[model samples]
Target: MNPYFCVMPFFGAELSSNSNKITPCCLLKNNSNIDEIRQKMLDHQQPVECSVCWNLEQKNIKSDRQYKNEAFDFYLNKDIKSIEEDCKKGLYSEQIIKIYTSNLCNSTCVTCDSYSSSAWSSLKGIKEKKSIISISALAQLDYSNIKMLSFVGGEPLYEKINFDILNYLIKAGNTNCFISIVTNGSVKLNPDQLNILKKFQNLNICLSIDGIGKRFEYIRYPLKWDLLLKNIELFKSLNINLSVSYTISNLNLLYYSETIDWFNKQNLPYNHNIVKYPLHFSINSLPKEFKSLLSIEAKHLLRKHLPQDDAQFVFFVKELGLQDNLKNISIKDYMPEMYDLIQKNI
Candidate 1:
């Protein structure tokens, strides 16, 4: 057996050890030769499955098979030793570590699955629970394997605790570690805070903005569009790498092109993703024209940045059409009850 194969369950291989049978998915053919599988796995250059894999798994059995295969290939070619070496160096590891700082957010966005009054109520008593990990614990972590440190939350910038943690990491002299923050861009980082972040050469900010002007403000309620724009400008002026992430939903589906055009005008890298409504909601109820617009935009974007990504974009467009008569109107004109459902989960 190849050394990489020693790590069983490569990507999507469902092995029923009791029966000694292997069910090959997209990553592996039903009767694929060992050499072919190994080569394909090597191409992925990583060990773990990403968000794409998770999204695919939630779809049909066919997608699960494809996801498994992709995962298997990723692990097969990952350089375990190199990752170990980087971690041991204690400077910067190639692996990405997402630290959930806190669940508190200032925004009451309708589509946010993490921000409800009840959710805030649940957190009230948990103050004594110590959700904030100690700085010493972070310093003692095995960084040799980590390539990036992502601070995610309901909103990381809302709390000082999250900033403190980030400050500690930067001071630790792990300059090689890439730091990423996923934020709503509502909170402004003061000059001192900005200076600390600037010390880390690899710091990147991903701002979540669903639409433009009133459309964005309506979906992400309690947030001012101008405030977000100001913060974005500040980040850009500081030479910080900034990206915009738009979560496509029924509320802003019609403004897909407008959203893209707006982000492009800002000269920021932007990505649009569909809202994965939880299991309770009917996927068939979503708007078809909205999905179609996203598919078209995705295809156009991929042509310039990721030629290979076009296939997946096409897949989603087709998936939307497969469902029964979902309304075909642009969502910008009307709000759906599904927005409330999303808020509850947030």
Candidate 2:
């Protein structure tokens, strides 16, 4: 087996939209000096900070780094050694910049908190100042061989700085690089923004919708269902390859069929990203016996509806088993529909 060497740093850098912290992936957050970080990347040493991928890899599961390796090969079309040599020196060369800094989201998703969403701060009585990654800050980075830049939010479209970055790239004539914007699909891009967005080498929009109809409104609280559907239709109308990011929790896991049917009808591709934070709202919070039953049922659904995802079935069970504590929430009060489904399954 090949050693776990992730060459992303040779070509990528993920930034905290709210802070100056930078790391290889969102799963790992580190405070090491930039020099040390670069050296570690060049060494191909799997640091402790990348435990998220490491854990998944230990279980023989594909990780973000694996996908990124394939992506690097396709996008850069350069040997890893050449990139490593550059990193070996103090100089930094970044191609993929995945930023999540704008705290200016309008909706307060049940799965997100104050740290990630400014709207959550106001709703929950926590206070936070809005932050933006100014063009000057980004300019400091070497964008010589840039291939992709991603903006994730609160909601990227809601912040003006995100638009500014788009304009910077377009004006700089860096239109051959891909741009990905992760949003709640509640906001629409204006004509001017859309015109420039279309100029990007490839513009991919990842819609973060947890459920549909009332279920969606509940999970992504304060969401306008009609507006969301309309927004999605607008992107699809452009023949854009829309991707769905479903954050599964016990609250909506039983509604698997509803989500599956919705995706099939729209012909939208999706991946399940189980919510493990705010433990009270996670599937791992369910009683072990309850989780066991859910595990069986979830696998059955996958087998019937998504046979290619046998590994995903194991993920659901393994993640639940790894969770140490269980703190039940008021599921019935929050989602009577899903609540009743669980009751029936009982």
Candidate 3:
């Protein structure tokens, strides 16, 4: 049976930087055998290359599949017959088009590498891979039915292409689309870009921040604490909807509660997606003692800030234990709480 007819499971696509090939999802690599994956998708069979979400499901983790599924179910005309016809017509009733084309960014974040950030290019000694969506290519794609256009980048604000696209869409009178961008919150949008942004029906900003003052600077690196705050206030003044993306990593594991409290005071909604890549950075890499202290702190914050899901407090320690056991370094030497918590928990 056609999955598109029902709640279509695999209707969305993500385009990566430097290579135009459509990927299974953002976390996975591009499908080398596009025709085969396309054929499997059309046949309502899950593509073999789409193991990222499949594995996530097996592990009982919420994957990118759920987010896209919700978008497709709500936006598309879900009458099974109409969707089936669209599928047979060889077109995706696409709900989201997540694009990442530029590696240009100001801060060379410790967790990121040259593949995603140009700032790390020289220091990383990796060959640059230049695969951006050109103007000629953008003009050829069909944006007629798409509902959401997500722009994620090395840093979206660092590239002129993002602003140009927004202006282009505004000029084209495409006001039905909901545009969202994930920025580092270090560079504020220019006056022209802000003015053009107001033309869209809706635009949302996800500020990528990891920690509180000193912790934040250490993790994101070279980004001044004051400047990041100034930029966040700048975005606030523009009167745009804002959300915080706190990537929970080992670098800031001890300060999650403080970071959440700071954003909570601003009445900003924040999400914590565990950092998986660069395994050493994952909170699971933290010493067991550090995780114990972090867990107690996170539990209280969850209760105080989000009483509805207080049970989620244990996620901190649970994730630490679940970490891939990469002990390349130890936090015990650095954190005083480690020595104290070790005695108590032990």
* lDDT tens digits, residue span 1-346, model 3: 4532222333555666666656535654543565566567667787666665665555554555555554454556465456555766776644567778588877766578677787767555567864476565566445665577788888887788888777666666776677778888887567787777777756778888887665566556557779878877877777778887778765566667777789899888766566655555544554443454565655332212332122232443343333212222233433344334534542
Pick the winner on lDDT between candidates 1 and 2: 2
TM-score of each: 0.57, 0.76, 0.70
lDDT of 3 at 268: 83
Q: Higher TM-score: candidate 1 or 2?
A: 2
lDDT of 1 at 326: 27
User: Best-fitting candidate, measured by lDDT?
Assistant: 2
Q: What is the C-alpha local distance difference test score of each model?
A: 0.51, 0.65, 0.62
C-alpha displacement of 138 in model 3, angstroms? 2.3
The better-scoring model by lDDT among 2 and 3 is: 2
Q: In candidate 2, which residue pairs get closer than 3 Å at backbone N, Cα or C atoms, i.e. clash?
A: 17-100, 17-101, 18-101
How would you encode candidate 2's per-residue C-alpha lDDT over 254-294 as one tens digit per residue? 66667868988988776556565555555444443344445
Model 2, position 216, has a per-residue lDDT of 79
List runs of model 3 lying over 4 Å from the truth.
1-10, 28-63, 71-91, 122-131, 296-346
Each model's RMSD to truth, in Å? 12.1, 7.3, 8.2
Clashes of 3: 1
